[model samples]
Target: MPYEVQGVVSRAKGEPVSLETVIVPDPGPGEAVVSVKACGVCHTDLHYREGGINDEFPFLLGHEAAGYVEQVGPGVTDLAPGDFVILNWRAVCGTCRACRRGRPWYCFNSHNANQSMTLADGTRLTPALGIGAFLEKTLVHAGQCTKVSPEAEPAVAGLLGCGVMAGLGAALNTGAVGRGDTVAVIGCGGVGDAAIAGSYLAGARTIIAVDTDDRKLEWAKGFGATHTINSRGLGQNDVVQAIRELTDSFGADVVIDAVGRPETWKQAFYARDLAGTLVLVGVPTPDMRLDDMPLIDFFARGGSLKSSWYGDCLPSRDFPMLIDLYLQGRLPLEKFVTERISVDGVERAFERMHKGEVLRSVVEFS
Candidate 1:
């Protein structure tokens, strides 16, 4: 039977999201119904509200989430009711070409609930990132649910579903920031700050954080940034030179563009040392272009330039281990939850996110 639940929904482009009666269907084959406990308000949710992602209106707008499985459809052998899990978008399809090559993290064909959740009028809803959890109950693919330590707070654990995971993966997996590697992360928002934290955890010697916001830069320091650069009112050369100056005049070994603008990406291109890796984890809009004559620079740079999709992370592996680390007091997962609000507060939370008032505004169901 389909269940009608109150959920945050963006009904049209540039329209405010409202709590609507969302029709969540019973789990079909390979699907599960999650009793969502908590979900984080991420920038992507804002993107959906603003029509920045796509024309997929009436989007069920929350993804970074954690909850417990309430029911599992037939053929779902691994997960059962009462299992605690973090919802992830990248539910790897084992048969994808990338998965066949043994790199499931790069699975081209990801999984979502086969059946559609709908509105009261039966208009199908596009669940954000395929694991919409702003609702009290959400339907998702069984593979999209990664079980983790139930002891972990749902608010903290949920962030691993998206932004935090993306940032951490940018450093640890894509950038490969190893011991003693000098790292510079542009934009000290939640994502960039996570890169800073990841770099610090990976033993980065000189961690430099660049952002226009001093408050965010201060937040970066808490995440173990050894140096902070206020990039506002400064030219690209100035920011690049500043980072170079901080890292023995050569430049950082890894430069991460967490801002995702063309200018920010170009700064990452020039702010790294010879043979240094550059990781672009920020989500750019469709219209943002990288034009100009930089053919010689791409060759002269002599390093890998990578785009980090969902931090190039494998949820099955990362979520559990990260939960353990968080429980062990090794990872500061709690720091990500800047504020906790109820589902009704998500629209205001989006405003807060736009103004950079919080790292993560989580919706707690309780």
Candidate 2:
């Protein structure tokens, strides 16, 4: 039987989300039903609520989640009922060119639930990131579930489902930060701080964190930032100069632009040592452009300028490893959860997120 549950839904653009009845169908072929325990409030969910993603109205808005498998549909052998898992947006199809090339992280064709969840009136609801989970239960493609150690708390482990993963992956995977490297992360929010943590874990010799907000900079310190720069009143060159000064008159080996604006990206481009890498992990609006940048700069600066899609992560491989690290206390994953909230508090959580008051406000199911 289909399950009817109360889920947070964005009925229209820019309007506050509300608790609505969501109809989640039983797992069909290659799908699974998960009993969601906790889901994080991320900036991406706020973007969806504001119509930044699309015109897909009435979005079932939550994706950064961890849960137990309640049921599995036909042909799903890897997971079974009671398996603890983190939900991932990208479910790689092995036949895709990227997957065939052994780079499934870049899989062009990812999977979501084959069936749609709906509102009480039978209107189809678009699940946020194809895994609407800000509720008691969710439906997803079987491949979307990545099993991990059950010892980690739901609120902490669920973060690997999105933002935290993006940050860690940006530094470790995309940037290829290594031991004794100098790294700088721009925009010290949850993602930027995660980058700092990743850099620390990778044995980066110096980690510089840049942000306009002092509070976030302090938060960065806890994540292992070796230096902090308040760039609020500084020009782009000034910010770049501060980073260079901190890195022994040379720029960092890797500079990550977690802000995603053209100005921040430019700073990151100039603040890297010659032939150093620049990783862009932040999400930008569609209308944002970089037409003014001189083409010669790209040629003059000889290094990789890469955009990290979900930190270029392979869920099946990364999620379990990260969970184990968290369990062993090697990774401070629990620090990311600023507060635990009831599902109804999500709208308020969005307000606090905009104000930069919390790293994450997770909705915990009773």
Candidate 3:
């Protein structure tokens, strides 16, 4: 029987999302039906609502989620009912070239459930990031479910499903930040702060956080930032100089541009020490461009300039490890959840997120 549940849906671009009836089908071959326990309200959901992702209308919102496997279809043996799991957008196809090369994290053929959930009227709804989870239940490719320690709180663990994972992977995987490295993260939102936390956990000697908001900077401090720079009214050079000043007249070993704007990217470009890595974890609009920088600058700067995709994470490996760390109190995953809201509160949560008032507003399912 198809399950009838309430899910947050964006019926049109720029319109407020509404709680509506979603009809989820039983798991098909290689699919699973999950009882969603919690889902985080992320900026990406807002982007989808505003049609920033694509013209796909009536999107089933909410992707950063954790849940229990309620049922698994045929051909699925690794997961079973009652398994607590974190949902991930990337479900690697083992036969892909990236996977054959033992780099499944870069899998070119990530997958979602073949079947689509629909509105009561039978209109197909696009699931946000392949996992529409704001409701009480969701359907996903079995591979999208990464079982982790059930001891971790749903609100906290679900965050690893997206933004937080991106930030952590930006430092831990993309930047390869190591002990004694000096790191600077620009943009102190959840993603940026997660980079700071990852840097701190990796034993960075100095962690400097740069942001326009003093409040966000303060949040960065709690995440283990050793220094803070308010770049509110400062020029690019001014921000770079402040970071250099904190690093003994040299720039940081790794500079992460979490703002993703051209200006912030430029700041990160100039704020790293010679041969230092620059990691871009922030998402930029399609209209944004970076053609003005002198071509010679790219040659003169002799280090890797990389963009992190889904934090370049391998869910089956990273998710369980992160959950273990969180359980051990070594990782402050719980700090990322500013508030737990009912499913209907996602619209208002977007306002709070836009105003930078909260790290994450998670929707808890009863």
Candidate 4:
């Protein structure tokens, strides 16, 4: 039987999201219905509300979520009801070229529920990042649901589904931070802080956090940044030079641009040592164009220039490892959850986020 539940929806850009009656269909082939426990208010959600993501109005707004499996479709053999799971957007299709090449993280064809969850009036709703999770229950491909330790807190565990995972994966997977490596992360938001923490976890000896926000800098310190640069008063060169000075006058081995603007990307481009890596984990806007590019600069600055997608995470692999680290007190996932909020508080959370008021305001469902 199909279930009807209240879900947050963006009826129009720049309009407040409301609780709408969403019709969730019974699981079809390869799908599962998850009873969402908690979801995080990511920048992507705000982008959806602002129509920054698309014209997909009446969008089912949340994606960073953890839940319990309520039902599994006919062909879904691995997942079963009552399983504790973290919902992920990327469900790699094995036949894709990326997956065939064994790089499932770069899978060109990802899967979602074949059936659509609709509005009460039968209007189809577009799910955010292919996983609409801000509701009481959501339908998703079974592959989107990865079982994790039931002991983990829903709020913190759900974060691994998005920003936090992106940052950590940027450093550990993309940047390949190693023992004694000098790493610098630009922007000290939740993602940036997570990169710093990931660098520390990967055994980086010097993790430099650069941000204009003093409060965010403080947060970065708790995430294991050995040094912080207040970029507000300093120009980009000054900030880069300061980081270089901190890294023994040699630029860091890896520099991550968590800010995602062209200015920050350029800063990261020039801030790393010769042959060092630069990982762009921040999302970029469509209108933003690169300028003043010299082909010589690209070649002279050798090493990988990469963008991290969902931290290149395979939920089945990364989530449990991160949760274990969290449980063991090695990773401070709890520190990232600055505030716990109810589902109705999402818009307000975005307001606070824009004001730089919180690291992460997680929505806890009763």
Candidate 5:
């Protein structure tokens, strides 16, 4: 039997999302139905609402979520009803070229449930990030479910499903930040702060946080940033010089652009040492493009230039480990949840997020 749930839906571009009757069908083969526990109100949700992601209107908004398995469909063996889980969009197919090469995090072919949820009129709804979670329940591929320790709070744990995971992965996996290295993270939002935490955890000696907002920069310090730069009125060269001067005239060993503008991207490129790495974890609008930077700089940079996909994380591997860290008084995951909100409050949360007033306004299901 199908279930009718109150869900947040974006029916048109540049319009506010609203409560709708979303019909969630029973799990099909290789799929599972999850009773969503908590879903973080992420920016990506707002992006979909604004048609920034694609023309896939009537999007089922929300993704970064933690839930429990309510039902498992045919051919599902790894998960069963009652299991606590965090939903991940990347359900890697082991046969994909990247997976075959043992880099499932870079899986060439990830998957979602074959069945689609719909409106009362039978119009298909595109699930945001293929894991629409801002409702009572959601359906996803079985592989999208990652089991975590029961001790983890749903709101905190669900964050690893997206932004937080992306930030941590940028430092630990992509930038490969290590002991005594200097790391400068541009944009001290949720993702930037996570990168700061990751850098500190990875033993980075000096973590420099740069952002136009003094509030965000102050928050970055709580996440272990050793220094901060408020680039509000500063020019690109001044910001670059300020960052470079912090690291004995070379530059940071790694520079991460949590703000994905062409200027920030270029700033990140120029703000790194000759052999340093730069990680881009920020999402840009479709209209944003970059072609001004000289092509030779890519060759001269001498190290990695990478885009962090969900922090290049393997959910099954990182989820439990991060949960354990959260339990042990390390990896203060709770900090990410700036405020708790009801599902209906998501639209307001998006507005607050846009104003940079919150790190994560999580929708905690009752």
Candidate 6:
């Protein structure tokens, strides 16, 4: 039997989201039903409501979630009911070419629930990032459920499900920031700070955080940034030069563009030392086009120009490792949870997020 659960949904473009009863089907083959304990409000959810992601109306919001496995479908052996898990969007297929090449992080095929959760009117809702999880219960593939230490709070563990992971992985995985390396993260939002913290974890001696907001810069400092640049009073070149000045008048070994925009991308391209890596983790809109780049710039840079998808995370691998770090007090995952809210407050949380008032407003389910 299908279960009825309350969820946040955007019925139309630019309209206010509200609580609605969504029908969650029972676990089918290779699927699992999760009793969501907490879910975080992310910018992507806001983009969906604003019609920024696509024209998919009546979209189910929320993806960064932590929950307990309520039931497991037939042929699912790795997970069972009572398992505490953080929901992951990327459920990698081992047979994908990328996986076969030993690069599972770049898995071309990921998994989601075979079943659909729809509205009372029977309109199929597109689950944001294939894991709409604002509801009290959500259905996803068994592989999407990554078991973590239940001792960790859901509010904190769920973050690894998305943005935070993106930031950390951008630095640690894509940027390959190493011990004593000079690292600069352009943008001091949650993702940027995560990159800073990741740099610190990777043993970077110097980590520079560049942002326009003073509050966010302060937050970056708490997350291991050795220096902060408030870019509001500075031009792109000025910020880049300031970053270089802090790094012995030479650009950093790795520069990450956490704010995905053409201008920022260009800045990141030119902000690094010769042969330094540039990692773009920010999400760009469809209307945004790349042009006017000198083809020589790509070759002249002499290093990788990469975009990180979900921080190129293999959830099964990274989630547990991050959880262990959190437990060991090495990663301050709890600091990212700026506020805990109810599911009804998601719209207001989006407003706070847009205004840069909070890092993450997590909706805690009773």
Candidate 5 residue-wise lDDT, 1-366, digit = tens: 998998999999999899999999999999999999999999888888888889978899999999899999999999989999999988999998899999999987898999999988999999999989989999999999999987788999999999999999999988899999999999999999999999998999999999999999999999999999999999999999999999999999999999999999989999999988889999887789898778888887787788998899999898899899889988988998899999889889989999999999999888
- The CA lDDT of each predicted structure is 0.94, 0.95, 0.95, 0.92, 0.93, 0.91
Off by over 4 Å in 6: 290-292
Looking at model 6, how many pairs of residues clash?
0
**Candidate 3 TM-score versus the reference:** 0.99
User: Judged by lDDT against the true structure, how good is candidate 3?
Assistant: 0.95
The local distance difference test score of model 4 is 0.92
Question: What is the Å distance of residue 105 in model 1 from its true position?
Answer: 0.6
Candidate 5 lDDT for residue 54: 91
In model 1, the worst 10-residue window by lDDT is 285-294
The 10 consecutive residues of candidate 3 with the worst lDDT sum are 290-299
Q: Give candidate 5's TM-score.
A: 0.98
For model 2, what is the error of residue 22's alpha carbon versus the real structure, in angstroms, after optimal superposition?
Answer: 0.9
Question: How many residue pairs clash in each candidate at the backbone level?
Answer: 0, 0, 0, 0, 1, 0
User: TM per model?
Assistant: 0.98, 0.99, 0.99, 0.98, 0.98, 0.98
Model 5 residue 141 distance off true place after TM-score fit, in angstroms:
0.6
lDDT of 6 by residue, 256-278 (tens): 99999988888888888888889
Off-target runs (Cα >4 Å) in candidate 1 are none
Q: What lDDT score is found at residue 75 in candidate 1? A: 99
Query: How does model 4 score by TM-score?
Result: 0.98
Worst 10 residues of 6 by lDDT: 282-291
Model 1 local distance difference test score: 0.94
